[model samples]
Target: MSFYNMVQSEKPATLLEIWEAISTAFTHNQNEQFQITDPRHGDFTVHIEQYADFSVMNNIYQPRQETLHIPIRPQVPSLLMSFCLSGKPGLSGDRWEASYEANQALFNVFPARNSTYVLPANTQHEDLVIKLEMHTPFLEEFTSDSDDQLSNLLYKATIHEESLHSLQGNLTIDQTASEILAGIQKCPYTGKLREVYMESQVKLLLVHQLSVVHRLQHSNKPDTTAKLTKADQEKLQELKLYLESHFLEDHSLQSLTKQFGLNLFKLKYGFKTLFNTSVMKFIDDKKLQYAHLLLQQENVTVFQVADTLHYGHYNNFSAAYKRKFGYSPQLLRKG
Candidate 1:
């Protein structure tokens, strides 16, 4: 991978300094875009919008390129939410590492020390990042409770100099957030109005993310007594991923027990503890979410979508879809 050392911080670095470091390799382009064409670094087009309390970096990485390394040093405390629309970008240190995956929406806190992020090669990467500074009022409400899950995740990293703070859930970019991102890329407003609109959308996106995270955290009260060993937890995660890819298949808890080499109690309760959802409910939710997308297609019908997802009856599928999305697939098609 090609390497570029980021601007170092004598103290906590601000977004402006980071921008300056990036600007060293990029040249201005038409319509606020910045392009980097160094043969060693690969091809990139980056767009940045920096405001007082928040900032956005919209990056597009072209294909047929080598991985590019950007070493990270300490920086000011901030919360960054990234929507990975395509390709993987990753960060790592000696002991801990994280790699962003396509279709995932993730957020992490930073005043980070001794980490590096790499841009992927061989695939086009499109990611939108919204950074929220901790010193600003934008995050004041979250600071009130030190015991709060999000508050702790966002604040602990700033104070703990040795730890690398990160948290990610299986949060995907749903249709609602995808539309908000589209609005930002095609925003018609100009000047102050443009900034206002963008900020409003950013807040809206965060609200959407928070709602999903809250639902995952609180919906199915976890089995507090269900303790999982590391091996058990990894098996549960593997089961979850299997369900994600094979949600259409009808799965009985008994079948799951045999397939994953887990007991009935662990499959039933440990699933809730780890994912905040029951095994069957999680699969059904994925089915409904997929049904929603199929309904948006030009020639697809609700019955077809239902049948395709292995729904036993189309009417049953319609009812489940309404309960989840607040509308029927038929209604979605009509709209």
Candidate 2:
């Protein structure tokens, strides 16, 4: 079957094993039936559940009914982005519900808990799912100081209804999704050019998302840091080496300046001149580069990398990871 068509007819023999493979590939969670690598940048796994007709028993004594998981919830905090390829999906919670027809999309942001969904008996659902985990930097940038901030941010993380209106561009839905999907597919996109492109696309997505949230009204202005001198570029290379060795630790401007014996202002200015990003952004970028390398290993945990990098917590790390890389740390773990 095409990679995109991989499906679970029934639950896998061992849910954990299946989850492991999915985790290795997609690094995110979903309701049991479907899993996928993000196609946005072409980066994760693809899991699906296709039903010509299906059902389940309810209340311990309803009837052998044809339904998908009648009442299901996602196990992770994700912004579920889906594009309806065909058929219709009936979604309900107590009294409020809606049907999403083919050619439309349903962006559902599921918090830490599940949405009590009742899929209609006759409904057939099909779509491309992009599972999102919040980035640590994003969370830290806006949340570190208070619980109320985190709560408000989390509740509002979902893509707003207005933003989901058909993307207005020359690219078709498949084209846009495929472009992002391709980026995701390029695992370990190394080299300076590749890294720049990867990071750039991610930043674009973030800016796009912020615009959706109305927090960012315009796209980011171009970066205009000065050109780096050859000497500074060499120093930056050394600095990156240091970051690689100490990927799990917190780094600061003063510490780096002292270690390199360079003036603090000069170091900061040179870093921007050379990298076209702030020193902290460069540090975060290197951390992300290392995290991508770690993701190649089968046993690394998302939290481990967070702790190694001195992230206060996994969620914090995740937010930063997403902001810097345009994807989630959890997705890497899934792969």
- Scored by TM-score, the top model is 1
Candidate 1 clashing pairs, residues 3+ apart or interchain: none
Scanning candidate 2 in windows of ten residues, the lowest lDDT window is 54-63
**Compared with the true structure, what per-residue lDDT tens digits does model 1 show for residues 1-335?**
11132212224333334334444322211124455444444456677777667777788875353565666654555666788877887766667677766656666665445567667678778888787766677666555688777565434544453222133343555557778889988999989999899889988887666656555556676434235554676688789889999998878999999999999988888787556679999999998888888889988877789889887888888889989999888888878
Candidate 1 regions with alpha-carbon error over 4 angstroms? 1-33, 39-41, 63-65, 141-170, 221-335
At residue 296, candidate 1 shows an lDDT of 90
- Candidate 1, residue 138: how far the Cα is off, in Å: 1.8
lDDT of 2 by residue, 143-208 (tens): 344455333444455423122222221111222343554464353655566546544554444333
